[model samples]
Each structure stands twice: as C-alpha cells, then as structure tokens.
Target: MDFGQIINLSLGYIFSPVTIAYALAAVGLAVHFGYAGLLNFGMAGFMAIGAYGYAISILSFGLPWWVGILIGCVGAMIFAFILGIPTLRLRADYLAIVTIAAAEIVRLLFTTQVFDEYTNSADGLGGYHAGFRGANPFPPGTYGFGPFTYSADQLWVRVFGLVLLGIAVYLVWALMRSPWGRVLKGIREDEDAVRSLGKNIFAYKMQALMIGGVFGALGGVVFALPSAVVPAVYQTSLTFFIWTILLLGGAATVFGPVVGAVIFWVLMAFLDAFLPALAAVGVLPITSIQAATLRFILVGVALMLIVIFRPQGIFGNKRELTFVK
Candidate 1:
C-alpha cells in the first residue's frame, strides 16, 4: 500500500469544494434541527433550487454572476417560505415527511422532460461556470506541493468556498449568541413555553427555516462551482449525509460542521482509497464494491455508537439536548 498516496487522498478532501459544501449544509442543518428543533428532511431541495436558480439566471437571463447568486438566495428563501408556511404549523415529523417528499418532487421536476428547454432535464447544464471563473484571481497554473495539489480553478473554488463557510460560521455564532437565538433555543425546548412568553413562534420558525435554507442553498451553489448542476446530486442521501456531518461534529456548536465536514470526508477518502486497493491486492477480504458499501456501513455504525453513548456529539453540550425529556 502506498501510504503516501493514502495521506494525500485523505488531505485532499480536507480542502475540497465538496467537503466545504457539506460543511455549509451541515451548518444549515444545525440551525434548523439543533437550535430551532425543526426537522427539515428536504435540505436537498434547497440545494437544488439554489443550484438551478443560479444556473438558470446565468444561462437564460444573461445575469451577472453576483446577480445569479442573488437570485439563488432569493429563490431558496421563497421556496422555504412556501414550503414552511403550511408545514411548519404541524409536528416536526410532519415537516420532515413533507420536506423529504418535497425534495423528491424537486428532483423529479428537474428530471422531467417538460422543462428541458431551460432545465436541460437529465443532462442538466454546464458552461455556466464561465462568469464565475472570470471572477477568479488565480493566474492560471497549478498550485500545491507534490501529489496533494490542485489546479488554479480548483484552488479558486476552495478559497471562495472557505470564505463563504467562514462567514456562515461567524453569522451563526453571532445569531445564536443574541436574544433571537435564545428564543429559538427556547422554542426548541418547549414551543408552548415560548409561545406563552409572547414571542412570534411561527414567524421565528419561518425565519429560521429561510435562513437555514439559504445556507443550504449557498452550499449548493459552491458545490456546483467545481462541477456541473446535475439533477442526480439533489437526492435524499445528500441531505442525510449533511445530517451525519452535523451529528458527528455536534449539532449545536458553531464550528462543529466545519470540523465534522473535514473529518468525515477525510475518513471517507482514506477508506475509499486504501481499503479497496488493499482488497484488490488480496491483503483484505472484501471486493471493491463491498469496500465501497462498507464505508457507508461504517458511517452508520459510527453514528449508532455515538447515539448509544454520546448522543450530544463531539462538540455538543448534553444540556442542549432535550431528548431525555
């Protein structure tokens, strides 16, 4: 086994756009479920809307890159408001069910042939990155050391994605430390109590939903920056993966998603790179496909162990969790 290659592959995910995107999505999940106790199971819907909104604006309306991003954020907010208005009034599980179903609805809509003119249906859209790439400051060259390097485009993506993630972390930290955040936490513990205190619980929940969803949208935008906006990326599993990242790092903590994203993706990269190769070389007892499936099994087992023991997660406060009640 090439230990050096293993290390490079692992660290590569540490700075990849995919990991940054998941970290952002996990942060949004933290806001929805951890702070406000809203079970949003359609985070992929937000991402899909964000990605499609940005891509469509650029490709159809000839909008500027910044304008496209604005469209993406606004589109996601409108989607969340529309989705939340009816569903937020119900039980958390209701929202979860609706959201997950809604996500599938969104994905199917993207795959539908009716909207092929704009959506491109299954083929999706590409070459939308030209405007984004025009904004790149890199001078067209590779940047990195040894095998652990990225092209100018890749480095630009990482830098921009990280900046967005940092801003998200700061904003969430500030919001959670304020009076507004307190009310959200209170609502999480007991909605009746929060309602009794004369706060607009529904409005706050809506705002939380929209705000958290914008993060997911932004994540989706960044996620597609290095790739194309394919319909397949907006599946339910993407939402679950973000949730896993949130749980692994601690749902309520400010930096949990960032650390969790890095760790989860790095571990996945390591496992994906080494285990299969080992198995192929007859040093391990699994096939290549089994190795791939086993990574997911490992993630599940890890989650189970965490829930069985430290359900609060690595950086989470046990006090913040109301599961006992």
Candidate 2:
C-alpha cells in the first residue's frame, strides 16, 4: 500500500502553508466561541474579505503587498463591526445564522460579474505574487530535509506564515492574560452578571468580534500566499473546518489551535494519501475517488465524537466549556 509514501505525504503537512492558515483561522474562532461565547458562523466571510481585499488592493489599486495586507485586516475589522452591531445584543444563535449567511454573501459578491475587473469574478485573482515574492530574503535555493523540503519561494511562504502564526499566538496569549481578556471570559460566562458590575458587555463582545475577525483576515492573507484567491475557497465548509480544528485542539487554550491544526491536517493528508493507495490494492470496497470522499465522512464522525465525548477538547478545561450555555 506504499505506506512510506503515505507517511511522507502526511508529514509534509506538519508545516504546510495550508496548516498555518487553518491554525490562524482556528485561533480566531477560539477567540469568538471559546473565550467570548460568540457563535460566529461567518469566519469564512472574514477570510474572504482578507484574501480579496489583499488581492484587489494590489491587482486593481496597484498597492504594495504590505499595504494590501493592511487593507485586508482593515476590511475584516469593518466586516466584524458590521456583523456585530445588530447581533451582539441578540442571542448567540442569531450571530451564527447571520455569520453563515454573511459569509455566503461575501463569497457570492466576489463571484458576481459586477466586480470582475477587481475580483476577476469566478475566475479568481492570480499573478499578484510578484510584489510579495520580491520581498523574500532567502535567495534562490532549496531548503529543509526529506518531505519537508521546499524551493526558495515555498520556503519563503512557509517562513512568513510561521512568523505570522507565532505573532498571533503571542498576541492571543498575552491578551487572554490581561484584565481585558478576563472581562471577555467573564462576558462569556455570564454577561448579565458582568453587566451588573457596570461593564459594557456589548463593547467587549464587539471588540472580541473585531479582534477575531482580524485574525481570520490574517489567516486569509496567509492562505492566499501560496495560491490564488478563489471564492470557492471561502465557502461555509471552510468555517466548519476551522471550527473542527478549534474544537479538536481545546478552544480556550492559547496553543490549542496550532496544535489542533497540525493534527487535523496531518491526519487529512495521511488519509488523502492512504485511502487512494488502499483502493488501488483492493483493500477497500470503493474506487479511489470514492475512497477520497470517505475522509470527509470520517472528519464529520470525528467532530461528532469530539462534541459528544470530549467537548472540552484536548487542551480545554471542562469548566471552560461554556458554549452549551
């Protein structure tokens, strides 16, 4: 069954750009559902805003790559403000509904013909890598060992993604340790009690939303680093995947997202490689394509098991499982 190839393929994802992107997005989700008790189902919307915002700024507006990143972050923050305003005071389920719908709206906007000049409509945007790649300092050469090897450009993207992930982890860790973070937790636990203490629950929720959105946006930027910006990439399924990663790693813990991302992607990569090989060897009663589809079903089953048996996740405290409330 070529287990060696499967193992190599799976191990390669341990530090892949896609893993980093999911980690960043999951961390943002952790901020929303884990710490703030926000049921944000539109995280994919924030990611789309970030990716399209960065691509459009550079491709259409002729902005620098750094400027495009700033625009993306700002765009996600604006989206957060828009989403949080009317919904923050409402039930958590309302935020979930609005976010999921808002994300689809964002994806469709990019797919529409009206903004084809900027977004390239359904074809998506590419050829914007020149500016970002120009800033690479690694020189022209291959790096790393075994399945982890990469050319100069790939190495540049992975290094950049890791740096951003590190900064995000530090930021979330630091913020969650402060008084403001304590208030966020308090809001999550009992907003009415916090409000009784004269704290502005709405403001805190809004701030958490914005912060998490910005993180999601940064994740989008990283996501686009290695590939083109496609509307299909930011669909509702992406948010669910991020949620799976967040819940798998222990949502309230600082390093949970990163750890969870690594584990999830590695397992996915392994299954992606192994399942097809098994099909070729007639080990499974399915075609290679059908075997490939089974991984998704496995993911769904895994998520259900986590929610039912280990809702706190690997790193989350049992007491911090406040999403049920």
Candidate 3:
C-alpha cells in the first residue's frame, strides 16, 4: 500500500470544492435546527433545486451564469415558502416530515421523463459551466504542491468555493449575533415565549426556512461547479452526511461546519485508502468493492460514539443540543 498516496488523498480534502460545498450546506442546517429549531429534513431538496435550476437555466434557457444562480436562489426560496406555509405553524416534526417528502418529490420530478428535454431526466444536465470558466481570473497553468496540483480552472473553482465558504461563515456569525438571530435562537429554545412577546413566530420560522434553503441552494451550486447536476447526487444520504458534519464540528458554532467538513473528509479519505490496502494485503477478508462500502460502516460507528459521548458536538454547547422541551 502506498501510504504517501493515502496521506495525499486525505490532505487533498482540505481544499476540495465538494468539502466546501457540504460545509456551506451544513452551515444552513446549523441556522435551521441549531438556531431556529426548525426541523428541515429535506435540505437535499434545496440543493437539488439550486443545482438543477442553475443548470437548466444555463442549458435550456441560455441564461448567464450569474442569472442562473439567481434563478436557482429564487427557486429555493419559493420551495421554502411553499413548504413552510402549511407546516411551519405546526410542531417541528411536521416540518421534518413535509420537508423530507418534498425533497423526494423534487428529486423524482427531475427524474421523470416528461421534463427530460430540460432536466435530461435520470441522466441529468451538463455542459453548463462554460460561463463559469470564462469568468475565471487565473492564468492558464497548474498550481500547488505535489499530489495537490490543479489546473487553472480547477484552482479557480476551489478558490471560488473558499470565498463563498468564508462569506457564509461570516454571514452566519453576524446573523447569529444580531437581534433577529437572538429571536431565532429564542424560537429554537422556546417558541411560545417569543410568540407571547408579540413576535410573529410563524413568520420567523418562514424566514429561517428561506434563509437556510438559500444557503443549501448556494451549496448545491458550488457542489455542481465541477460536475453535472445529477439527481442521484441529492439523495437522502446527502442530507444525513451534512447532518453528520454539522454535528461533528459544532452545530451552533460559526466555524464548526468548516472544521467538521475538513475532518470528515480527511477521515473518509484515510479509511477509504487504508481499507482497500488492507484488503489487497489479505489482512481483510473483503474485496475492494466491499472495502468501499465498509468505510461508511466505520464512519457510522464513529458517529454513534460521538453522539453517545459528546452529543453537543466538538464545538457546540450543551444548551444548543437541548432542542427538545
């Protein structure tokens, strides 16, 4: 087994655009469940809208990159509004049920043959990143150290993702520090109290949903920066993965998502690399394919341990974990 390759792969996740995208999505979750106490289980739906909306606008409608992003954001906000309207006034579990169903609906809609002209159905949409690449400022060349080198376009995408992540972290930090954020937290802790104080609890929940959905949408866009907008990529597991990262870092902390994303990907890379090597050396009684599946099992065990011993997460407070009555 090439240990050097394993280390390189693990380290590469530090600057990966995918990691940044998940971090951004997890940040949105932090705002929803961690701050507003909204149970939004269909986060993947927001991401799907973001990715599909942007790609469809670009490929089918011939919209520019920025316009495509705007369309996606609008789509996510609309979805949030629609989902929140009927369920936000109810218990948190209702929102969770509705959101998860809505997410599945969105994914299945995109997979239907009726919209294949635009959505490409199950195959998904691609070849829409030309405008994004055209806007790249970096000169044409490879950059970075051994095993970390990336071409000009790849580097541009990573840099762009980093900037977005930074903006998201700062925005969450600032929002959580404001009066509006305090009210959101109050809602999270005790919605009845905030409602008794004359604040429109329903409206606040709706606003929180919209904000978090927008962040998830932005995350989807960033995630699709280097790949096609595939419906399969926005499955329920994606939401669970984001939740893992959110809780792993610190659900309510500003930088927890970022830190958690780095750690999660690094550990994933290391295990993915090491397990296959062990299998190859006959120490493990599994094929390479089975080894790939085992990584998640290991990750699940680790997450179980974290949940049992440190329910507050790495950077979260015990109070933050008290989302229940």
Query: Which candidate's TM-score is highest?
Result: 2
Per-residue accuracy of model 2 over 160-271 as CA lDDT, tens digit each: 9999899999999999999999999999898899999999999999999999999999999999998999998888999999999999999899999999999999999999
- Tens-digit per-residue lDDT, 1-325, candidate 3: 8999899989998888889889989999998888888878899999999999899999998999989988998999999999988988878778788888999999999999999899999999899999999999999998999767999999998998889888888999999999999999998888889989999998988898998898899999999989899999999989989888988998788888889999998899889999989999998999988998899998888888888888778998977765523
User: For model 3, what is the error of residue 281's alpha carbon versus the real structure, in angstroms, after optimal superposition?
Assistant: 0.3
lDDT of each structure? 0.89, 0.93, 0.89
Query: For candidate 1, lDDT tens digit of each residue in 143-193?
Result: 988645888888898999999999999999999999999999999999999
Better of 1 and 2 by lDDT: 2
Q: Please, what is the TM-score per model? A: 0.97, 0.99, 0.98
Query: Which candidate achieves the best lDDT against the true structure?
Result: 2
Residue pairs clashing in model 1 are none
The superposed Cα distance between candidate 3 and the true structure at residue 3, in angstroms, equals 0.5
All candidates: CA RMSD (Å): 1.2, 0.8, 1.1
- Any runs in candidate 2 off by more than 4 Å, and if so which? none
How many backbone collisions does model 1 have? 0
